[model samples]
Target: MTNARIAALAALGVGALVLAALGAPPLVVAALVAVAGALEVVGQLGPIALRSTLRTPDAVSRAAAAAAALAALVTTGVTAATVCAGAAAVVALGVVWLEGLVGYAWREATRVVERLPGYTAPHSLGARQQVITAGWYLAVVLATLTADGRSGELVLGLAALVVALGTAAAFVLVTRAAIRAKATVTARIAQALRSYDAPVMVYLSGPEGTEYQLGVWLRTLERLSVRLVVVVRETALARVVAGMTSLPVVSAPAMADLEGLQVETFRVALYVNNGAKNGHNVRYRELTHVQLLHGDSDKPSSYNPVTAMFDKIFVAGQAGIDRYAAHGVEIPADKFVVVGRPQVADIAAAAPGAPLRTVLYAPTWTGFNQDNDFGSLDPTGPAIVRALLARGWTVVFRPHPYSLDDARSLAAIEEIHQLLEADAAASGHEHVFGDRASSTMSIVDCFNLSDALVSDVSSVPADYLYSAKPFVITQVDDGPSDAFLDEFPLARASYVARLKEPGSLEAALDALEHDASSSEREAMRSYYLGDFPRDEYADVFGRAVEALVASRCPAPAAPVPGTPGGAR
Candidate 1:
């Protein structure tokens, strides 16, 4: 607690004791406690998380708390005050429970299970929380009846509230049932209507949106010998068939889509993320599910608990093999296939002279929320860019797509662009924020143009490792374990800068461009990516997919290890 709050709490406690000494009713003492609790909660959760309580069961709880306060002031006998005291307890408990629900704070329960590590199916985390809360509420309400002076009326009122909330929950379930039934029927129609057969199904099984990463998998594996079909959940990606790949795009809108389709036809089912829909695809009695992750990065997503479910994981090299084993996910050794990223072949190679000029300042996005977000664009991007510009290196600022989704990141990107716009011509150092400063510029082209990469702990460094070029990765924060650093050897190999230090970027660039960092960078690349035979990674990746199709055996330690939360 802050010193001010601690002192205030002490004073408040003394005042409560003074009121009780003056012969104030017990209900008044209870009311004082409840009000103080509300203040403590406001301090803890803040106002925004508590806002929902103003409309929920918490509203009734607050009213009951008020009645307790009124009774404490007016009631002379014990019965009125006893009932009011019980009401205060009920209200306080209800308000807390309701507020917790509104903010989805109880979802943190999964962290307990997450401690087990490896892929476990998704759990009904929110439902589990509600049950636990209700149990606490019941225990507290019953305890209130054991008070020195209690009434029958308080018991009746508490029972009625329980019955009311239970019915409301049941009604919501019924509404959800209707919606699910309709979806199930639609999915069935999709499966039955299409007479699709493929040896390999590239399952684009994330939620409705966020299938952009699938483009790389599609583009890389398009030249495979096994019959390939793209399975997506949205119809909007029909253009993927026409524009992105040679394979037919199968859109599954619901679960019934899996039921009606011939599951036996596909020899291999490729999975990326552990979306609930993907879980349904895995449940197929026959097909072999391969976890072809979107990218090989040091991020937690790369070695998720969900990975245990795949029959095989098409990993880049030895690094991925060591990663899962080190994280305590014990998958069979044979399942971790060393397939160099086929897409790397498509990325532009380092020019004959690529250590000094035209640096690619590509920083990763601040993930879906703050916790997972590793974006340095806002904190250190401009300082590093200005430093590079000062050094007379032509800078190409390519920000992550999701980075500019928010106002804060968008503003940061704008500052970098404005700096480039004002200074590019004057400094005789031309820069490209092409397509009017949009993400339209391809990553391959970006790699082709720049000599070195400056990125966060994202797939960028892994991808750049293939170019046999120098790159710098940022250490967003301290407290990363020794294991995490080892899993991502690139951090050890390349120019690793702390976000707070712009000079680190300069140091990495200076060393790589003019010193022996190039040799160390190459060794790190070899360690992570294994041996690459020229630029023929596509051929290697194709053979891995073909081998999976040949075996048709599922991988052990599936992500779903029976948890329902494994669902999207």
Candidate 2:
């Protein structure tokens, strides 16, 4: 056996002996060690990585990660000094030997390649790196086995081996299944659906109105030849289809049924974020998922590592590109087309009244490892809201969704209290306020009515930027650190101020009121939205859709919804 593996077994044996001597329960130790080992292995070697062309590391991130790891180890125990020291020495020596072997192998390979033309030689990594990796794996397994070693030898060894092997197999199998299922479902779904001359599908998630608006955008814009087919949550599908006679709204079918469709051909399948998660085998259906985000946030929302499933990304602007890139997210840069803000601007245009001058106070959700500097940054959110109210400036206070106390019916109540308490001693009009509403309602209605917006790194601010409205960004921290640096690149297009000291709220508010002019709004818009030629969004986006759709298997003749025995 390898030295690392042998060391791991030795560590396990030591743990079992220690537990027996201490009169401690072996089962308990085994459970703890198993969990720790699993986590360590997962951290050291990822479960499954989605291959992508876009990959970049953020600076200072590695240092922060190291500090976090050290903190975790310190919190766990200081008594493992001897064991840790021994393990470190072994790991170091193993790594050095591994490096030397790797170097020799590399030299030999180089020689072979130089002597033989058109021959590819093997490349080897350093022994040190290999040992370090192997040692970590062994340590994890040993720790796990030791922790549970009190159980009978046969049971413990068998259980640990089975669990490890089963877990690895499950991960690999599931990934393979998902990939295979994608092609099967896409082909089947394409066959079942009817062919419309102009492909028009309303891809929407969230609530019903958003889907309706998407449908409207496709229908009213005659410049782009399109048909209406609403893709909504299964719950709303029947209602949407029943009301609209000219086209069919395709609700997500049961996964088993999608593999049986005979219909084919679609120009576009506009996919709203989170829509596919609601159903199985939806993405495998071969249409291009044109991802339209629900809101225009500069930060990473839908930007998860799993976003590699998407074939094309419809982003807001260059800010979206930079935010996705800086965070190691893998969206094909070539596949991402800057289509501008689609949903928010349409909402703004539809709002009635004499364009009410309003200021939106939107704070990101605060709870569990979140930055909680709302009071210092805008200790006067309610005061400002009240002041704006007195001045006939309608104010919409949209607190973070998580900020809602369980007892409080709405998040707005607690948010107003947080804002009021900050300046209640002096404002005197703390009790004075208008009727409150949720941020969702405000985003769909009030943001367009507002003349300006006040927010702290909220997506609401970015969505408002689309309207060319004046916006003031609240910086909750004093200076740019690692966390701050990681997020600021996203809002490079917005008007931002890092509130360094206390009592800067009034001045910040004043600056927003005075400075948020059409000129400044236009300048920021020109910088971010200047990339796309306005009229070509559909054509540019449509070509991508066509390629994805045409590549799918042709619909079978008279194919039933499911089963191989059915019509083919």
Candidate 3:
């Protein structure tokens, strides 16, 4: 049978099943099938993005027809089959009324708004439309079946209605033009197969939402090697990742599409988290995954499942290793190495003292949930920064990336700055300002120049443990606000301050500025950032890369059929 015939058969089969499930009588099912089928016909116009303005009338007509079909179903479901004809009329009227309401609402809403055509075109008939149509049809058929007592004629009528309606719906949706063209997938495969001159593989989470630390990591990787290929999502992120890494990058298609790419001698896949969503097979089977995950020293990570798959796991500190172990994430102790974050390492090595010290104030973004009360900086963030500046510290406001990008957040910062400027005593230094060009500065740089670190619950403080400098966390709330720091205990390296209480920030700054001891700094540094071995992570990293290449290149005792031809 032709593809069209198959499509029709599928639709008819589904409709018959619906009839059976609903136990609806014939006429009710027929109306629903028509509505559903009509919408499918309307869908032939193609995507809403490409349609012309003339499709509006057709769209309205289809919406009315579908709505009417639903009304018929409802009436039939509630009433007997003897009244099926009357129920259909009432249902059709209801659809007409809804169509009018929708049309009016659309016009009023879009009156001043310029609507490009095709916006409403695809609604002519789709899955959502069909679902409602089928539901209505089912309701009416059941009512008719119940009223007619499931007689031979009634059963045959219902079955015929189901088939006819289902066939029509299928023909509408699975049109000749709607046939799947495998050419695009084939082209994508071809693209993946092309040989690269020098390919560098970079694995990152979906682009755009990466932490500032990632920027530091990307920059460090590019400086060390030239042929960097970033494996990330397609479209907008490809440009951003390419721009950030300053290297040519390629995104991997689905796992099957990865078959053709030539594996580079230097290619390394990096993992920032232990999540399974990142595709276990693609990273483990096809590439050399370098796990530089994003989580802290809390709880067992998703990394446990695929620990054996990685070439190397770049850990933060002993605490990180201990935490992972405590949580049952098994790492081959020998393979796990403490490569101080390449990004953090770069930040640490930057010229120690800037002309003036800067305070990097960052906070996490409120997630999609309405319960976003947590993780806000003390309302007194600006006031506290002012207090620090009074004692001779330049505050560089770095709100969370989400907050920084949001218009309301930028406006709030501007308002706060104005509040500070209004006070003659507060405007003491040019250094107390938001770094407008923050997109260029890595989070590590923010840490490097900071004389004292001040933040609420953020991974920055955890990272700041490496600096072992005077640190202060605002006790924004008396309660679990400190859970993040308390759980890690690494935060005690810095003085903790309360935000709600008066003079808390001033007092913390005073202690940080005058009373911090070298011993304290050393203890914190050792705990958070372990000492680098041989003074060179590059040599260490290079060696790790070489080891991975050696392991993968030499054929194992037995190789799988689909495995990369073991470095031969």
Candidate 4:
């Protein structure tokens, strides 16, 4: 519990005890009990509306509620000074503990059901349990209020007892139904898999919020001719992917569970990121493992030594292969395949001399560690956005989703949003921020809407190259030097905004106005995204995947001796 909750509980419990000790009226003690009960309900059920996952009230919270209810019962008995009321209070306490135990069991049962393969526990399960628990607490409050030895108190106490029992019975029924439903779903999924024959499988395994990495490849995978399945190692991700696409999705969180999938016809498995869980699927040698890193960029993730685990690494162009050698991470030449990024096929070429200019300022996120912290949002983001607004350019501010993982990046994002929103209201400029820029519009959409781009040393700039538009790459250090340019070759053809320099941002904006690097950008576009025609890039990737699947298919077993097709 938070400190505030603990304080509240202590105050409620202490106040009830003091009121009883001072011979205060019974109604006053009951009011405190009622407020405590309401607090418990709010604490248990409030967060359910905000979260996407199943959130259950923990044992500590339940114990705290029980303590408050018991304290209220004891105070009522003492205030009345009746042996009959004290005996009734003891009975009420027993019922409350019973209710808590049943609630705890129900929560555990739901968790077990959720872990079963192919079963995603519905949100309704948590909602219903919390409602029933709330009802039980309310019943305890009512019983405590009526526990005095008055003439009609017995009838009221009995009614409250009946309500509490009804809630417990309802909880038991819900738990049983959830478990049965999960078993039925698991059986149906297993039956379907027994007949399914998918030659290509996309195996992704990441934490809850990393679904975006898998999302980037779903459309491309759907365009392939071969039958495919998407297998995930996180149950939450599996549930999300199922909602996002029509393709079959399986959650195999353990090695044994993965083996039980029984995908004998599977020929190839594609992976998106270099998550540690990739090792679990890579051990299956019968399936050819291929790495399709989410995007091609100058970051070290593009050339990690772990890429050697895959049988093949599909990249956008020759620069991807050259990057490995440059970074001194070697894999055999034949393992590399240039499948031009089909996702960028829709990015339109830049339209020069437009009447109104718009710039997309998309900085990357702070990565897993300090070595990967290439984001410029903290120190340079507000300055860059202000420069664009000052130059009368509409701004589309889209930061990386993971950027919010850092407090500083989140604050910077909010600051930029405030600036854009206020400027839009005042100057009549059409600025995009909040969900419109971050969620509703894809990066490709942002690229088409804007005339120029400003971003960090990440995939946004690399992908933005498809437009052949002028872009400014932000450098948080002193300025771009030979080593920086050599490390990030895509920067060679673009304006570099040395954020440390006082006027470097404005200089890059001015350079963008003149289209000074048009020729270099066009050249780098071919070098980075490959020379494939925009219309045919997706087909290139699809055909390459089909060829790999065919090449890796298991050789047909010899016909059984004495069978119809046998030599005998």
The numbered model that scores best in lDDT is 4
- lDDT per residue for candidate 1 within 1-568, as digits (tens), equals 2335534544443444455456565545554544444443434331111222443333334333333333343333445434454444455445444543543222111211111112232333334334433433333333233232445645644553454355335424533443344434333333432334457877775532355567657667667776766666543343333345666655554455545544556777887666666777777858878887887877777877788777778888788788777778788887778888777777665666644777888888887666567778877788878877887888888887666556888888889988898787688677988453345666777887877778888888888988877777777776453643675666876777766554656676676566456677677676677687765656998887877776774555545745864544
lDDT of 2 by residue, 110-138 (tens): 22111111222232223322233334334
lDDT ranking, high to low = 4, 1, 3, 2
Candidate 4, residues 1-568, lDDT tens digits: the string is 3336645755664575566456555566667656765665565552222111212233333333334444545545443333333343444445445544444333322322222234444435657756765666565555555644456666656666666667767766875675555444434444455557778878888876688898888888887888787888765567667767767777775565566655677888999999998988899999889999988898999999999999999999888999999989989999999988888988897666664488999999878887687889996798789888999899999998888667988889889989998899999999988899878998888999988899989888888888888889987777447878998898888898888888888888788778777788888888888899877876988998899988987679999989989987
What is the alpha-carbon lDDT of model 2 when measured against the actual structure? Answer: 0.44
The TM-score obtained by model 3 is 0.56
Worst 10 residues of 3 by lDDT: 109-118
lDDT of each: 0.60, 0.44, 0.49, 0.72
Q: Between 2 and 3, whose TM-score is larger?
A: 3
Per-prediction TM-score, please?
A: 0.61, 0.47, 0.56, 0.79
lDDT head-to-head 3 vs 4, winner: 4
Local accuracy of candidate 3 as per-residue lDDT tens digits, 1-568: 2235334533543463366346555455554445444444444332111112323343333333333334434434443333443344344334434444333222221111011111122113334334444443443344334334345634433443444345344433433222232223324323432333333455554534553435646555666533445555333344345555555554443344343334444345666654454663344454566776664433224235565567667765666566556556677787677655444554463233333355666554443343333334434555665675565656665667666555655666676566545543555655544555255555666777666677764456766665555567655556553574654465466676767666767777777666445466566655555566525744445455545545655465775566776444
- Against the hidden true structure, what lDDT does model 4 obtain? 0.72
Candidate 3 colliding pairs: 24-141, 24-142, 25-141, 73-136, 200-229, 272-293
Residue 179 CA error for candidate 1 (Å)? 15
* Model 4 CA deviation exceeding 4 Å by range: 1-63, 78-188, 352-356, 556-568
Leading candidate by TM-score? 4
